[model samples]
Target: MLKQTLQQKLLQKLSPQQIQFIKLLQVPTVSLDTRIKEELEENPALEDGSLANMNEPIEDYPDKDPDEQFNSEESSFDEEFSVDEYIQEDDYKDYGGNYNGDDDEERKEIPIAIQDSFFEKLQNQLDLLALSDKNYLIGQQIIGSLDDDGYLRRPIPSLVDDLSFSQNTFVEESEVEDMLKVIQEFDPPGIGARDLQECLLIQLKKKDQENPTIVLATRVVEDYLEEFTKKHYDKIEKQLGVNSEELKDIINEILKLNPKPGDSGAVAGKQLHVIPDFHISNNDGVLHLTLNGRNAPELRVSKSYQEMFEHYEKVEKSDKKMKEAVQFVKQKLDSAKWFIDAIKQRQQTLLKTMNAIMEYQYEYFLTGDDRVLKPMILKDIADRIDMDISTVSRVANSKYVQTEFGTFLLKSFFSEAIQTDSGEEVSNKEVKKILEECIANEDKRKPLADEKLTEILKDKGYSIARRTVAKYREAMNIPVARLRKEL
Candidate 1:
């Protein structure tokens, strides 16, 4: 079975440069600076154009064209062409640009704030508590156990065991629970609750308990949580013996309580900052689209590095060491050139794709009208721009475009076509717009159901099913009729 045979088959593969370009193409305007900074730090031959030599005049030097110098078969580094003695730093190898799609999800990274994290803030609060060393440590453990939504998810017995094994500070369940209660009263009314009911009650108890509304709200949250959540107003009224108007005030009071106190700005969670990848403007009835300048950073080959390479190339009549040095320099120069080229291509591709989308959805962009949006998919833009669907998708993911209406995700513009009674195809965005209008204007006492909404769409000439209406409603984050009921 050791026989060998020649084989022939057609195959396709992306070159290193192509792979680099593809990755750079997908990075949104938000992280482009970080990616470039990484490239600058890694390759000595690459540098920020802002810091590059600008006073020097351009001259036709022999090493002026790095692409040609890089590709020419003048010299190459092989095993024999080693220069271990001259170079002191770590040996440079082939470069593989940062990402394999950056990651499968392409989620935007939130900028890390210098301020202490949520847990740290709680720890600071714990520092103020007057307790013994052991009690303080127990309090620290409880504060650490709180989740981002601000609930103590871990059980008391579990914390007791954790302290016993990890900290060697064995304590009973009751002791741990006492410390938890003490910390829960620190700040943000519901800091230490174990469940939704406890959280709401903690906030309610912090309010004016003497108020009839607060008293009724507590009763509702404690006894009628299920009915309240399901909008069974009738059941709640009959059980509590309260009129509809009285119950309405109590519901309003309960609604004011913070369901997730941990997410409150005073405690934890950094504020979200959205950096748009593109900006579109409608001026004099004409739309102009432009990519974010940050996306196209001005990068150039390091002049000093190029000069060093030229110096090594000039001392001709040299040995293997000199040639090896030249090869190393050439490799870096090549990477620097490729990275700059990829950046430019990424910029071009982004503009191309966005332009195609703008033209495709011109009416909507012109007036900020969802009803005018056309049925568009990734493939439509891909075909127009002569690119792959995945490429279009990469551009769309987690990316925002600033427009007259507001900053919106690019994926929001794309929707499947639905047929009208006249056989005219329309974007599902139009149907959603109508559904939103219907629900927004409907009487909260008798909210329209999905079936009724479907009939309304049908009457408006959109042929849609009840399930389809429900799906659209869910997609829009609109609650059902029963949940939407006020009293």
Candidate 2:
């Protein structure tokens, strides 16, 4: 039995050019230059040039049929690739366009900072210590064991084993501990603490040792740390027999101690620098939007590539080598043209989408006020621009816009709408902002719980539930009331 069936169906697929465009759309302005440079290096037919001489037309362009030149029967590169099938030989010439790169000029190189790392500082301090060779090695071992938070995460027994096997020098944990104690007394107050408690105590001990509050603060930390952390002022008062004023002073003293000592000195990770992709300026109640020029370079097909294609097209068809050369040149020209067109299209799409966003959040842009920001999502801008939601998301994910007030990621401007008790719509960002203010102004000794936070929002006409309030608080990295409590 032979079975042949025909059914009606619709299929969707992305072409190579479309895929490339999607990838480029998501790339932020900061990294777009690097990505362009990479393309330039990989594609020989591509180049970087300025648009100053764009009016000068490309001379002697080619008109070779890729299908006839690189026929399937005569495959040259072993891969079953049809150059004609991949290339669209339409009118790719820009009769009045120029290159995207600048002319040859002096380039300035940014100088790199040469500074000692955090570990280097520790090593230098260890050198100043008057220890014997064994003790020096132990000191080095201890310093290496410290985590980025400046705490010794590794146990002394592990260090003992590390010295025994790795360094071939057997040493007791006691010796290692003793050296660790000396290193703990280094410049950074809590550089060698084993835990958070130790880290805080180390910093507090470094303060005015004769201060009476210091002793009480140390007692609070050492004996009733749990109560102090939970803001159980009454419990602490009963246990330590301290009045409100005295407890307040003791708690204030504890608060002054550094929780993360390593952060006080050199940073442990690479710092990121943000480069905004768009600029929105407010002038006399008018808003102007401009995309970063780096993202919209004046790209055009390579003139030399066009000339090469023209030269190859003139060669006799009988010459096998010349025909292959013609196919190669045609393929390169097609690629360069497609790349240039894609870049141009990307610029146009970016402007269209960003302009729509600017108009959608016009009030917020003019006032630079988060409260004025309307509830907006990807689909809102996508519908306005007549594009897919994914496309708008790509533009928003990594892009930043600089305003009169400051720079912000485009994604930050998008938020879901929340209906108020008055049946009015407000952005979830507004609710979060209000929630943050309420927490900031609450009594730290008896921090407002999430239930109370929800009630407070309700009182302000925002009908938010306790769970939703908790979710919002957690999203902002704000701790629960118990964790937020301060003695």
Go through the candidates in order and give each one's C-alpha lDDT: 0.80, 0.77
lDDT tens string, model 2, 1-487? 9999999997443444554566667777776676666667767787776634677554332221211222335322333323244434322222222223333256343454676778888999999878899999999998888886688989889999999988899998789888888998997888899887888788888888799899889888888888877677889888888898999899898888877777645674445667788999888999888888888765566778888888777867788888888888776766666566567667777788889999999999988778888999998998897777888887898789999999998899999999988899999999999989999999987899998998889999999778899999999999999888765
lDDT of 1 by residue, 1-487 (tens): 6998999997443345555666676666666776777788889898887655566543221211111113334323332212242122333332333322233245666555677766777888889878999999899889878888889989888999899988999888888878887887877789889999999988888888789889999999999999999999999999999999999999999899888887764444445556788999988999999888778676878888999988887888369888888888887898787778778777777788789999999989999999999999998998898777877887787578999889998989999999999999999999999999999999999999999998999899998999999999999999999999996
List candidate 1 stretches off by more than 4 Å: 1-3, 52-117, 265-269, 314-318
Ten residues in a row with the worst lDDT in model 2? 61-70
Instruction: Give per-model CA RMSD.
Output: 6.9, 7.5
Q: Runs in model 2 with CA error above 4 Å?
A: 1-12, 56-113, 266-270, 317-328, 443-446, 482-487
Q: Could you tell me every candidate's TM-score relative to the true structure? A: 0.84, 0.83
